[model samples]
Target: MLGILGLDELTERVYRELIHLGPSSVEALALRLSLDRDRVHRSVQMLEAKALASRNAVGQVQTAPPQLALGALLTAQRHALGQAELTAAALAEAYHSASTRSMHDLVEVAVGADQVRQRFEHIQLSAETELLALVQSTPEVVEPGQSFAEEEAVRRGVHYRVVIERPMLEEPGAMESVLGEVLGPERIRVVESVSTRVLIADRGTVMLPLTESPQVAEREGRRLDEVGEPMALVSRAPGLVTAMLGLFEYVWQRAVPVRLADDGLDAASADSAPTTLDLRILSLLLVGSTDAAIAKQLGLGLRTVQRRVAHMMELAGVTTRLQLGWQAHERGWLS
Candidate 1:
């Protein structure tokens, strides 16, 4: 029972025997436990160190009163724990400094969904400035309540920017749920497709799946299977992180922004703009289709599609195509 205070089994046994026998000699304890005298002597020394036993002037070992002895042991244990906590704090600081110096060796390979999720939560909690994520598909291994960490991070002022694929928004109330959980719609963007799943923090650390071929992953943006064990790569390499930042920025520019109704519009007000044809164009834009692709899908000329898009942008009072999409959604044109 007192082993937590550094008492070995033999010491505890001898101490109990001494307490029971009442002021016993080492030989007597050895005989009672069927242990050798030398072993019993060693246990006495350990018990003395723990303040559980003491020696009189005649060199006879005596067990201290259990009340006093146990109390002293508990106090010593508390003091030791306090010191250990201080030492741990100092060690953590040193480790952080060393990790910063060893960025090249920071790349790690984690196997299975649990490990990937754990790494993601750690990165989010450690983020100081901003977080950028390209979510192509949801992993099936999400632990219950794990999303609370992300919500807390956002509340603490970590600038979060997530680009989600269009297909994920097809689920009923999906957009509403995301907007409610995150700070607002401005933090999210939608793309027709995402090439890969990525999470980058502070432009210093990057993480992505390792099981898929990079080229195929980028080209197809396939969903990860729920039953499959996924592997991920985490890195803090400066050059690699820089390249990832560039990729995120490129996608961010082309992606359509999501504007929430709460930003300033009632349901009726939002449903007041854009004709059916303009709504069709906005739908294609939401899925990340190009002007030519939009024209081909709607059986219209490329120039005609471009002209309509430009007119919508003018009506929405936005300069960029992506911003136009945001306004269309804001006005409930694509709702």
Candidate 2:
């Protein structure tokens, strides 16, 4: 029974013999059992480590005789182990809760950068449907391991969309190559603003750099790496995801659409850049503004706000209102 329970066979044998043979010195125990003195001493050491035996003043080992108290000691050990397990579980829950809380709720020192990256990676691998990203750095700076495995994942029907800043497209390296290869002019959208790094997966999870301008290219590669357990929270609350999606749409509507016209379109005000009216509509929506309020603020019909929001969702490739919010925030659509 002890063997089945993971006890070493030799330890079990030694323990049983000690129980049956009465308290004896190591030499006596070894001679009686026909085992090496060194082996007997080592087994005695193991028993001492577990508090199952003791050593006398002369450095001789003594096994505790089995008694009613032995059962109590075993029970105490089981209880202590149970308490340790529970404490560990509780701490894990607390850490996850702290990680998900907003910046307002964060009182502790900033977590290590590696910890944040690992958490983000966990979100990426577990994505079920779509991955909406607002990239602050080049793709090469994010996920350098753009291996065939990732290509295989996309081949298997993953919806991968990225809203990149203008500076990255104009610059060189993996960012330029990735944009040309994966996004291209037709597939990409440009948000012309200083961006915070954001990675959202399947609408269920999100990862972002806690810093205003994360040195993502210098520190972490393409993707925000994941930390801790796979399912653990990598950033602020899930509610923030809604805010970010709305913000992405807000930006997408105003952002200059990238086209495949052979010549890149020049960014100019004459091109009907987003005006103050667009900004007002975004502000209203971010504050949970109803269609009527948005229209009143922007001097448009209630139907207009609805139509624009719908169009924004289409541009961002999201379905529901909440997803739109997440997309918006991810793309720096809002302030």
Candidate 3:
């Protein structure tokens, strides 16, 4: 209907009369449509505003070509409708994806420090069964005890597992405080190095940096903190969670246990134990150091290094080096 194009009945009739009569005076148009002259003049003015009609010097209104005028309006509206259709379809796709809990909701980006901090706390507080951490910083620097919510998470019987890299081990008192006080030594492990920081809760949700490390970014000549605040991503997608958990497991299995309490008892080593020198020797061995290399590093005789290793194996009741490594880890002797 022409009404859909912003023309009411009287305005449309006046336009139609102009088209039919070629050109007509306002008074004649009003007489023919049975309308007052003033109303007809207003309709003609509206038609002129819409470019559907105009007056010549003689003051008679003439219609523009219908195809050029109304056709253009129709074409513009069709274009607008097409754009609206695309928007609607996209919204519907998002709605359906959300309703099904599909992979479309894979990564939720948290930009800026406040958002990243909130996500970090959310993952820790929302954990139901287990909390796994991959920390590159000192254990105490990451989160310490009297560990407020961390203690609360522990109280809820949430299993906490932490793996720290060598950089963390280099920190003073890195192992004696924080998680040590809250979770004990058995919950902690250490590896030669960890690629990045990750916090996973119940293998269900993960919070991690949005991009790779600055070292990685530097290869492309971009700084990670160029935008001032770091960004983090939280994912609840099942596949992503499983993949992240797999990565954690891969790192955890190879990590040796930390000695949280300097005086803690080791059932395997209680009678004749590995001393500070012995633990250092074991730490070197875990990094693939030979007996000769271990002796040189620790200023001990090669025989002394070999004897300490052999004695440790005997204390662990293990016959092979591999089994001894496992047993030493179980007894929490390595760094």
Q: Model 2, 219: alpha-carbon shift in Å? A: 16
Over 11-93, each residue of candidate 1 has an lDDT whose tens digit, in order, gives: 98998888888887888889889999999999999989887899877777998899988988798889999999999999999
TM-score for all models, in order of appearance: 0.48, 0.37, 0.53
lDDT of 2 at 260: 21
C-alpha root-mean-square deviation, each candidate: 16.8, 18.6, 10.3
Each model's lDDT comes to 0.74, 0.58, 0.74
Number of clashing pairs per prediction, in order: 1, 35, 0
Which wins on lDDT, candidate 1 or candidate 2?
1
Query: Which regions of candidate 3 deviate over 4 angstroms?
Result: 1-106, 138-147, 212-228, 261-269, 272-335
Give the winner by TM-score.
3
lDDT for model 2 comes to 0.58
Model 1 root-mean-square deviation: 16.8
Better of 2 and 3 by lDDT: 3
Model 3 weakest 10-residue run by lDDT: 138-147
Superposed Cα deviation of residue 73, candidate 3 (Å): 16
